[model samples]
Target: MRRLFTGLAAGFLLLGTAACGSSDGSGASDAGAASGGTTTLKVGVIPILDVAPVYLGQKQGFYAKRGLKLQLIPAQGGAAIVPGVVSGQFQFGFSNTTSLLVAQSKKLPVKAVANGVASTAEDGADFAGITVKKGSPLTSPKQLAGKKVAVNTLNNICDTSIRESVRKDGGDASKVEFVEMPFDQMPAALAGGQVDAACTPEPALATVKAAGGKSIASNFFDVSPDLTVAMYFTSQQYAQKNPELVKRFQEATIESLKYADSHPDEVREILTTYTKIPDTLLGRLTLPRWPAEPDRASIERLARLAQQDGLFKQSPDLDKLLP
Candidate 1:
């Protein structure tokens, strides 16, 4: 989706670097030491609530103080974003952990350099989880077998962690049917009985709950209390070529994550900039944990679950994939 790039570009004014990220020979995404020696890098990102911290961080001048800035190009999935980073069109990319692991499994040279977002670790109180209609008979994840469940992306973080929740609850995860749809559509889909359940995050989750939907399981929390759902990544080639740049990005991003975690009001306010989430839903929504470090234990657990689910052609090498 080249149009994803153009649409995302049109949504926000280009500011500065894709920082915490990369470099390639052509360096088309790079500004080549502009802004009084500050480098601007283009980052491939999805325009969603999960990415608010980076925007907030940029506005807070965390990146600027580090001589970095962001140019976030929008794309819907890892399929497009990963390739963009590999091709040097985007110096960095933001994606869920599973996509990066799957890329590693397939021998793609993607490397995770910074933490993204995480689960609240509290069942029924998490930002994202498996939800059911208020009056539905399904009260637990174990009852989810042979039922329709919606997720924004199938076979990625949503379904993978959901399966873990199912298995933990003594259900046959493979028998659970995953229906793919956007998070915004899930509230109506659940209320209308179009899907039995949905693995959704806020603000859509907030919408669903307000409409009498009940979260049956904290899937991400079930996987690990510190489940690192998403991350900011770059190509291995770029990391090797420019370790210092990557390090700066990593440090700045962790600082940003810490800042964002502590400043919920600012984070909530920043969500209005890139996304069209309603103020009413925004206040009710659960904010996810934006940790300063990627939980390696949780990631390893994710890799194991992915392997069990046959997501890998071969086992992913965590040593290479994570920084």
Candidate 2:
């Protein structure tokens, strides 16, 4: 967990400027040189169901057809990926809306390129949920107050959305204690009573559910039925310098998102390629909505909720942030 914060801090320190590592206008890694003949771009991604589309797209040759290749690096969360993208360690990254908003508030030179994922918007049936052990007495989001809740990262999307759920249930969100744990570790932690609850997304959500965990609320749904949970992004410098490559990436990604949205079985099969999610759970896990573009209204609503929760130091400028 220390690596999560350390890597982000290092990213900020390593890249004093957006053009720190690059010397020319191609805005590519040294490995992506002409010597290789194929432009392979590194992208930092989280190991979650939300990122399944890009993998599917890659397998489907969307990026290859665009004369690009992806080297997806599994990151703990946006804490690392944000800085990785900004520092040029990754040409692109996947991050939640609030974390991107928080990065924007800090004046980080980053911009979202395409929609990553969204909520199913079905009450108690969304892709991610706030879950407690089945035998636990807690049956509502309001009960999260005065209890410890585990989130992948603190002050980012997981906690921010959970706070909204608690507040919507008429509970004081501030009273909730958020414990920082990786998504993979959450199932065991919740089962062992290491935390009172967890904000889990599939297939971890599926694992917890298989363990008899009962979801009390759909946090993303509680925030907004149209909430744009996450998106694919790149450093502003990378976007500015590599306009053509970025355009190719955007086109490929949007196609990938659309393809994944319509093909559920392919997505389940692709999960086996990068993650260790079991076959039995794959059939039961709820997949997120993959919209070709983000919902600006939902993002705006999240910005307002982030403000209410004190996650941002300054207002998020959507015009410059969104694609």
Candidate 3:
């Protein structure tokens, strides 16, 4: 569940003008200068379920202990965050594996330092699902033929997973048209009949359902097995320039993941601050485990999905992309 932070806007606005400086701490071997002798880190994120670890790290002060002052930037989408890293606007950001893989294929300087969350198998009772308005003619992927479908972004996880599911369900994915919409607005758009179906992750899925939408498919892993839904990225330049700092960032994130895994109840209590999801919707949502290390095969599969979905023109060398 994503938390709703009332003060988040102020936080982002304040951090935007903050200075970069160096720190005396031992975490990052290659440190950059920031205010108060802290190595500043700018991380990009989309307000969604996969951002639990980021919130955990921030609230728990995991980054601070590593001699890093982390700044969180709420981005438009996973794909939209890539350029921030590539252009040095952010040292690292939370992005889906598919986007990172596609970016790497084009020789973008990026690497997945940590895994965010894994999707469950189909019919696994997870909140991630393909939803349509109640009483809509589209009861399954087969009915979506030649219909207008909605995704948060094309070629990203939302569209890719939906396409794969449709293909497996005897639907011609090529015949379907996709339009971009944010997770928060999916319910309104669906209710307004802007699209036939929406491929979304919760609390959007929950929202659509609460507003009388029917779920046709659930679990992203059922659509594509071992899908690495999201991850944190640092450019090749950032990694090379600050090896110890990147490693420290990774270590802190791993610790936060462990805490989130072990303390789900505590996580739920503070979720409203990061996301607008209500407490009643929390029980239905399933938060997947965060991998301790990045899985190369999953990253490669995302690359292949990107290529299959026409997001990337070529497949990247998976082995060379891993840190």
Worst 10 residues of 2 by lDDT: 23-32
* Residue 154 lDDT, candidate 3, scale 0-100: 58
Using lDDT as the measure, which candidate wins? 2
For residues 155-198, write the lDDT of model 3, one tens digit per residue: 67777777777887888978878888788888888899999888
Give the Cα error of residue 152 in candidate 2, in Å.
Answer: 0.5
lDDT of 1 by residue, 1-323 (tens): 23433433432222113322323824532345433577776788876678888898899898888778788777765545666676566778898898788778767779999998998877668888888888999999999999999987656888899999999999999899988777777888999999999987777777778888788889999999888999999988887877767777888888889998999998888987876677877788799999878899999999999989887757899999887
Query: Candidate 1: which stretches are off by over 4 Å?
Result: 1-31, 34-38
Stretches of candidate 2 off by over 4 Å are 1-10, 14-36
C-alpha TM-scores of all predictions: 0.86, 0.93, 0.86
Worst lDDT window (10 residues) for model 3? 1-10
By lDDT: ranked, best first: 2, 1, 3
Better of 1 and 2 by lDDT: 2
Query: Candidate 3: which stretches are off by over 4 Å?
Result: 1-29, 33-36
Better candidate by lDDT, 2 or 3? 2
